[model samples]
Target chain A: MSGNMNLTLKIWRQKNNKAKGELVNYKVADISPDMSFLEMFDVLNEQLITKGDEPVAFDHDCREGICGICSMHINGRPHGPKHGITTCQLHMRSFKDGDTIVVEPWRAQAFPVIKDLAVDRSAFDRIIAAGGYVSVNTGNAQDGNTLPVPKTDADMAFAAAACIGCGACVAACKNASAMLFVSAKVNQLAHLPQGQPERMERVRAMVAQMDKEGFGSCTNTGACEAECPKEISLVNIAAMNRDYLRANLLDSEG
Target chain B: MGVFSFLLKSSIGKKIIMGLTGLFLIIFLVVHCGVNALIFMNDGGVLFNEAAEFMATNILIRTMEIVLFLGILVHIFQGLYLVFENKKARPVSYAMTNGNANSKWYSRSMGLLGTLLLIFLIIHLRHFWYVSRLTNELNANETLFDEMKEVFSLLWVVMVYLLGMISLSYHLMHGFQSAFQTLGWNHKKYTPIISAIGFCYSIIIPLIFSIMPIAFYLGWIK
Candidate 1:
């Protein structure tokens, strides 16, 4: 193609969690602008394999943006330098022909890098396990209309539920705070009638898990919301705060 | 109680403390600014001294002063604690970060701004609060306003006050709205209004505060 571009990539190459990492440089040529960022990486890996060099290790499950598995802090931004898109959604068109791209894994104490560009985000899975789900007996599905949900409440819950558990919020935050992700989980349930049964306890447990995970406290900088692939609102954080305060102050069970 | 301990221990709980104490300090600034603004009357410190005496002697104000100090201390201690904890969250630093790509510089810089304000507060308290509240060091004839005149006479002191107000401006700019968010007071309809009010408050209060020392130093007020 006439517009095929060549680029320089400085990728963080780490052996394991205990080993030190460094940015190693490589050049990619004749990259099509239509290729997704991950596809571009695939091309680079193919070249490395052909050359008998170890391919750079990164994480990705779905080429589509929904899976939340693809993570790269490209050029100082989580999921590359675009807004409201995951790394898998980022295209080569976002970069110029001569641009130098730097990619690194999400950097946080809770998320130790497993390899070159893959950090163990099991900390997030544990937080979800803590209380991110509602406890309901496994039976036939309850009728949707059985619980009357206000339209506004349903919409708010839906918005909060869009969070795909990607750790971009953590990556983007200067403190590596997971407030945005935790708030999304908390608020998604807090706004639903089914969520009411364990609303207070859920917030408490999830927050305890979040703190235990060694993620930083939020400073309300709105960085997470800005960089979120799902564009999760910071209002979730506020709602989570309200729920947490109520959980601690007004919950009679304690 | 378990709840009290939760408030003291949890991450969200610590932020709630910051937000509540910050709002209290915000209100205190309004009162402090209003009282100090009386010097603008330029009546050789007569009205200003009366207000100052009333503040010192009033039982209600005296009690609130203790509450104010407690609020300030809690705010300071909690802030320092959070800064320490936040630093530990990211053990491995990014090779490059564009924080300005997502949030305002001042929003990310609350700790630094707050530390500057703390330093300013110490100097400010030493200059006026210590002399007026703790000691009989002031000449009997010199009112608190006269003390202000004497203290602001120095170009360096005035410069420090100006720097302090600048820090206060940025700190309040982020803090006012951040407190509301932390307290779970944000709403789509109400938050914009709160943010606008906060923006004006941050600028106006700090501007008035900066003007005080400048007015004294430049003889704009007697």
Candidate 2:
């Protein structure tokens, strides 16, 4: 109880996709600053269960920040007040003693709230399925030395491949645009020799699916890059734009 | 959809159109400001009048004027469409949003600033373009410079012009480099140069435009 803090929480509580949601208030005491944000939620849920009340529902997997499932729009930000982090990676220490926190689900037409702080981000799955991969016949792996990808391209491709498929970029963007997420997927593939066969078609099909998902258009505001947990650069977006343009104008296979 | 329809309907395609038209308008601003600065010569508007006469009568300039109008129309309509779609993307609004945490206020407020500029454009066209080109209201020997002087003389009109210029400044601040980025021109080597040029352009061009109204109203140029 020495450094433990008591806090107030305003959390969005929604029943289901069709139901309306409201921010319900609660209180927690003796919260240790060392606990991860999700652990803090675990404590809250335990408290609710003791009181015979329904616990707040949220999404989480691999609290180590990789699975990209943890999502909480906390205190008017995607993953609390931290930069370049997922909600699971945030710790209770980020808050001051006796602070009031607000948490909500990602609000976008393409990402509907499932319950409480969880949203249905299957839209990203559909986009990936559209063309976020390269097709190759089932055979032995090709020799890595055979295709000598330049150092610069490999580095850029690796950087872009770091995207965790989190919807934080959409949550941070004013337009709720999924450009950062979609572009990351596009650039990761487009930079490698393995992606050359379907580079043009991938950009075209992925963009079409992204638009169909009702996500807003990118305005080059850079919010997505600023808020990305993996620190994915906005350059991915520019590259995707370039690829999409070439696909539309120059690609003869269209 | 075919390529043409894709260009018209796709989200990225719409943005490309916005970027292209925005760059065109940015160039037009430079030319417009350069020509308007001729008033500083203070040669009884003689040089300014000659330049205005040539701009009015030159066949190439006349044709480009039509193209310029079309660009403006496309930019405005496309911008409005994007704003509408963006709003719909998040129909269930957040209870609290701190947009300033990740992006600049002007970058987030492009639609609002652009709307203000549209209002300014209407007043601007009526004051100068309509009087000199579309109407016979000006007597013989009255130049476009005369109309500017008469218009800027009004305190309210001068205030409106100054407000318009401020809005234009913020719009360009976000728009100039944004146009380049949307066009996929972002490069580590060239983007910094583009951003630097954009920053200077956003300030210098709008400053020049603001000075025209202030100079006329304060009797600095007359």
Best by lDDT: 1
Error of 1 at A98 (Å): 1.3
CA lDDT of B114 in candidate 1?
91
Note the chain A TM-score of all models in turn. 0.97, 0.98
lDDT digits (tens) for residues B52-101 of candidate 2: 98898899999999999999999999999899999999999888787888
Candidate 2 local lDDT, A1-254, one digit each (tens):
78889999999999999998999999999999999989999999999999999899999989998989998899898988899899989999999889999999999999998888889999999999999987886367778787799999999999999999989999999999999999999999898888999999999999999999999999988889988999999999999999999999888885
| Tens digits of per-residue lDDT for model 1, B62-82 | 999999999999999999999
Evaluate every candidate with DockQ and list the scores: 0.88, 0.81
Instruction: Give the 10-residue window scoring lowest on summed lDDT in candidate 2 chain A.
Output: A137-146
Candidate 1 — which pairs collide? none
Per-prediction count of colliding residue pairs? 0, 0
Clashes of 2: 0
Q: If candidate 1 were superposed on the true structure by all CA atoms, what would the RMSD be? A: 1.3
For all candidates in order, the CA lDDT equals 0.93, 0.92
